[model samples]
Target chain A: EAGVTQSPTHLIKTRGQQATLRCSPISGHTSVYWYQQALGLGLQFLLWYDEGEERNRGNFPPRFSGRQFPNYSSELNVNALELEDSALYLCASSLAFGTNLPDTQYFGPGTRLTVL
Target chain B: SQKIEQNSEALNIQEGKTATLTCNYTNYSPAYLQWYRQDPGRGPVFLLLIRENEKEKRKERLKVTFDTTLKQSLFHITASQPADSATYLCALVRPGGKLTFGQGTILTVHP
Candidate 1:
């Protein structure tokens, strides 16, 4: 009955350094998604992993990447971070059954990454 | 390409009144549309879902309307309370199983 959980409620790092954010999906969920929410930018899609494969990604650059574990947890790694990279990183999970899943996505509390 | 949009301005409604929010999209025919509630410093929580074929859906005090022709969705909170204040987001899954979220609209219900 636990919802999605993320580590490092807050993160602070300098520009040019790498940042790693972790996410654990709800129990029994198989699809994990990553999103970045910043001022004015809204919640932008970053990546989607299903069944341990990189299924789809958003308009973000290649430096933004992630992997889903066999247990359905995931990690997002941002390389060459810039000042603009600072934002709340959210992780979501959904059932892999397909369209009938109601397309309902449950989100995590998120990791607030502040790049200085 | 595909895009989703929501009212960017904050909506202020008096407690016990009804609040209406809008979600619109372009360049895609989604099978289903969703509504989520998010609070400050936290991620979004699933609120409701309505399929394209369906006209309306209601959960507790929330009601969602979908219009495929208009490519728009409406979210309504009836008998609102001060605790209802939060940002509401709309999202849709593409044919490829990727979800696209709207910018979200902030709702502030005052007592």
Candidate 2:
């Protein structure tokens, strides 16, 4: 089975620009998560979507947003990008919502966004 | 609010020895604590997941111990090798079912 797959393995954008990164979750997986892995920031959760609905989000700003599709694919959008936004944007997939059974997340290779 | 913490410093140990990493948390309880291994320029790979009620779980040479009392989890890699050198991350299941990660601890196994 294809693990979670993300588009644009690497991205480069200038300040004030907008960036869109995409993700396709594993087959039959209904939950997709987005995380930002910046230098010194480790990995921080940005959003969690289940069955195409926004379930939860992290402390990230409004500029950091994303949406999930019916097929469990997701896209993360960062607007008015800043230099600090240059980091690895990872997308993960899990089973259905509210199910904690071995609720481990399977991640994609990630989109490395570099905002200049 | 719940906070998870790991050693920000890098750990260096000789090969063939056991490498132990720690993850500590404060405030509420977690349903399960998970361990992940991440290489440079790569996404994190799931290592092990131990539930709150479970004391210890092992897979191959890797072992994870969860102590809900201490609100901590310990990850161990026995007979460590140079290939085991990477950053190990710890995560806790949040109230809404999201996984909250801590700052990973980089482990370097000297040959």
**Candidate 2 residue pairs in backbone clash:** none
- Model 1 misplacement above 4 A: A97-102
Clash count, predicted structure 1: 0
RMSD of 2: 1.3
Give the number of the best model, judged by lDDT.
2
iRMSD per prediction, in order: 2.2, 2.1
Clashing pairs in 1: none
Where does the lowest 10-residue lDDT sum fall in candidate 2 chain B? B93-102
- By DockQ, the best candidate is 2
lDDT of each residue in A1-116, candidate 2, tens digit only:
88999999999999999999999998988999999999767898899888898888899899988898877799999999999999999999988886544268999999999999
lDDT of 2 by residue, B32-52 (tens): 899999998889999999888
Off by over 4 Å in 2: A100-102
For candidate 2, the share of real interface contacts preserved is: 0.68
Best candidate (score: TM-score): 2
- What are the lDDT scores of the predictions, listed in order? 0.89, 0.90
